[model samples]
Target chain A: MDDKDRELLRILEENSRLSVEEIGSMTNLIPAEIEARIHALEESKIIRKYTTVINWEKAGNAEVSAIIELKVSPERDFGYDRIAERLSRFKEVRTLRLITGTYDLQLMVSGKNMQDVSRFVSEHVAPMDRIRETATHIVMKSYKENGNTLFEQQEAERLPYSF
Target chain B: MRNFVSDRAREIPPSGIRKFFDLVMTMDDVISLGVGEPDFRTPWNICESGIYSIEQGVTSYTSNRGLQTLRDALSARLASQYQLKYSPDDEMIITTGVSEALDIAVRAIVNPGDEILIAEPSYVSYAPCVTLAGGTPVPVECTEEDHFRLNPDKLLEKITPKTRALIINFPNNPTGAVMKKEDLEPIADILSDKDLLLISDEVYSELTYESSHTAAATVKDLWERTITLNGFSKAYAMTGWRVGFLCAPKDICDAALKIHQYVMLCAPVMGQVGAVEALRSAEDEKTSMVNEYRLRRNMFVAGLNKIGLTCHVPEGAFYAFPSVRGTGLSDVDFAERLLKEQKVAVVPGSVFGRGGDYHLRCAYAVSRKDLSEALTRMETFISGL
Candidate 1:
């Protein structure tokens, strides 16, 4: 990314709700310039999504999440890409990655509870036609996610001094 | 009527940095680059620890020297980071902030009628703290030619028989100047021959960019006479925690603790708990935070230079002390005019002391948007002038 593109992404990453004028002011770009740059970023898919990270447990959604390791036998032409694409199409799958080592793919799966996650894994994932083996580890807690903390924000209290 | 205040307190001058802030309060939509505070909140885990402490009934006073556990954490962190060792029990005292630590260190070291040489465009608190401690604050000029780094010869020129202490703040306050170990060796050489004390306020030490920070205490034999003060305020974004610590020789620490015990018993217990968490997990958090500030510094510094205001590449801290001489305005006038015309607020560099007359300090701690906006406004203001 160019310098301006990097700065624009950083600003949007911090607070995507900021107005075009606000972004422009911070980037030293005019409003039109900001609009054009953001438009370009969106078209290029550099900014794939703008979403808020919620403290879901606090939000009353006590969903159980797990990172599932899959040892898959790839189909001929596409290697792991075909299976990876199919797995990503599942609404329960938050993230999927093809890998090296003992595991072929890593999937972030979530459901209402432990039983729900188990059912999804046993019924849907484990019985897949290309399946080899699967190991699931539930995420008991999250310390940090997506550069954000799952806690209520604290009030700022900096001293009003230059030093 | 009773005369309440001490003569020492009365003699200390109020900070000039406040003047613009006062004006800013009366204005609307002013984008301030005035206060040198981080816009980032204290990291989540650190704050969580503080909240956890409160939930666990960890309220009440800690030891006058602060909690043993906290001090031990600090001691270990310092030892691993700087190779400077201190006994947690007797050689360290956790104060309310670097402000309080600096105050008591000055009070503990200075006798009446002594002189404390401070390099200028320094932190605003240094001179006032010296005066309040009944010592003369001698301002030694550090020009832009040296990138605001203290020159040993200029320091030597300011010293006299009564010069008992020298205060150095690296990754400095307004100038954002940092000194390499080699840049400091000659000053240490000059100081080693004297019986003077070195009060190194390294609160911004961790915020340094590119170059590694070398704590003054790590200099040859400088540890014996150096009082190194650091805090969670700048690095861990825990300014509200009011947690800071000083590491000195046992004798000096004991002396400072005497003042700390009477004036301020201990830092807040919850803050200490948070500080422990910071020492434990803040390495990665601070690294990322420093990286963000580095990007902002690059953008802001380049913007100022492009607009005809010459700025030294600030190697550390979050400030850009760009010279406003090209605009044909004094530092105060430039700041004032910028605030009035463009509604952007920055501090006049002279408020920081000598060799800062032609510059203004713009803190890049604001959001990237605000920094960009402030720079644009400043450019317009300067061009019109």
Candidate 2:
């Protein structure tokens, strides 16, 4: 991507909430003009959905997060997309990315305890015929979450602007 | 064998502010100035009224136009504050916020491709709201050189055959500029003979510092065609309460109420009660808040100027728009780098409109304690830049 487009992406990757006017200021384009460029970016599939990132840990919810690996038996009739769709309907799955290694999907799930995790597997996941054999790894410590976020670490200080 | 999504949906990228806030949400010790909402609680009397409303079990919907008492309070307050008159029963409707008011007004009036005049840098909602309502948002860039007021000549020149409405927002967001009656006179005159309407946003009307606010509707020939928007959010620190108001002619209110009746049904019932309490009493609470903001604007402008940034001494609203030229970086770069380095957050200006080049808008609605510490950190950071 060119510098301007990359700059747009860099900013967007940082905050999808930035207004077209604000994005234009960053790139020296007028709001109406930037609106057009932003539209072009979306058309190119460079800019995706705008989602809020919540600090759930600080939101008075005491929970544990773990990334589980699953090897799903893809249905002959519906394929992997249907399997992924079915797996995604749960609220605990923070993310469920299909991958190409020892596991078919890398799942991020949060729970109150080990029993909660076990129940999620027993009731919701293992019961599904879109069959999946799973491996669980509780994150002992997150030096980093999602490449550059501070989501993994424990801290005592109160955060500004509560969720 | 494959279906495709249209290029139009694909072309528009999502908002950049959302992404940055997400990242900021992750990192540690991030002293955020990112959010634009006020730090103060909705005033106590207002909160009590809301509680009273809930306790009295007034949970069901009010009239589609809203609680009659709150509308009367709003009409009386508008008269007391800006000398504008409206028969609240006929002219006003309680809305979700000024944002929704803009929506219903535009939808009720403009046709597809109809041009709506807006001054920039302005609130982020204006253009997008206009576009969604199937009208063209023609931004007339108001400059800092002209004290951030819309140039009448530029505005007059931009008017076209398709121009159906003019949206005036003051004291404007981002820049915090308010237009005096003198500034509104010419535009009012021009519209006298035209087939057009005025959607005046006075959400920040209660916070003016230098001069008394003059509602455009108070200017003769303007009131007849004007749809005035004001809200409990800014003046009462009730952003989350979700109550605002709109005043226009009976015919237009009739059309807007239909769409609003289906879309919103009614504004939050307790919110309407809280708003009435806010409007009726604690006049000094409003005064005290404005006084504090006035002090903040003075201090902020002085500090920014002392640190080599140039900002207009704003007349109203609670933000300071400082030119970020001394740092030798673009406004966006300055904002990103400042946040990444110093851990202080401020919105870059262009987000308001094209009129906001080389500027950063700092909201002073945060606590003075936070503002003080933020300034100290900012000074050290800008010195290095």
User: Chain B TM per candidate, please?
Assistant: 0.98, 0.95
- Native-to-model Cα distance after best TM-score fit, residue A123 in candidate 1, in Å: 12
- Expressed as tens digits, the lDDT of each residue in B1-385 for candidate 2 is 6659654344334564665566577776556665555666667888998998899999999999999999888788788878888888888999998888888998999888899999888887788778777788999889988888888788888899999989888888878898998888887887776767999988888889889899999887888899999898888888888898889999999999998999998999998988888877868788767766765666567667877889888888788888987778988888888788888878888777777878988887776557767777788888887
Please provide TM-scores, in order, for all candidate models, with all chains considered together.
Answer: 0.79, 0.69
TM-score winner among the candidates? 1
lDDT (CA) per prediction? 0.88, 0.80
The worst-scoring run of ten residues by lDDT in candidate 1 chain A lies at A154-163
**What residue pairs are clashing in model 1?**
A25-B373, A26-B369
Lowest summed lDDT over 10 consecutive residues: which window, candidate 1 chain B?
A: B15-24
> Least accurate stretch of 10 residues (summed lDDT) in model 2 chain B?
B7-16
**Deviation in angstroms for A121 in model 2?**
71
Evaluate every candidate with DockQ and list the scores: 0.22, 0.04
Off by over 4 Å in 2: A1-163, B1-13
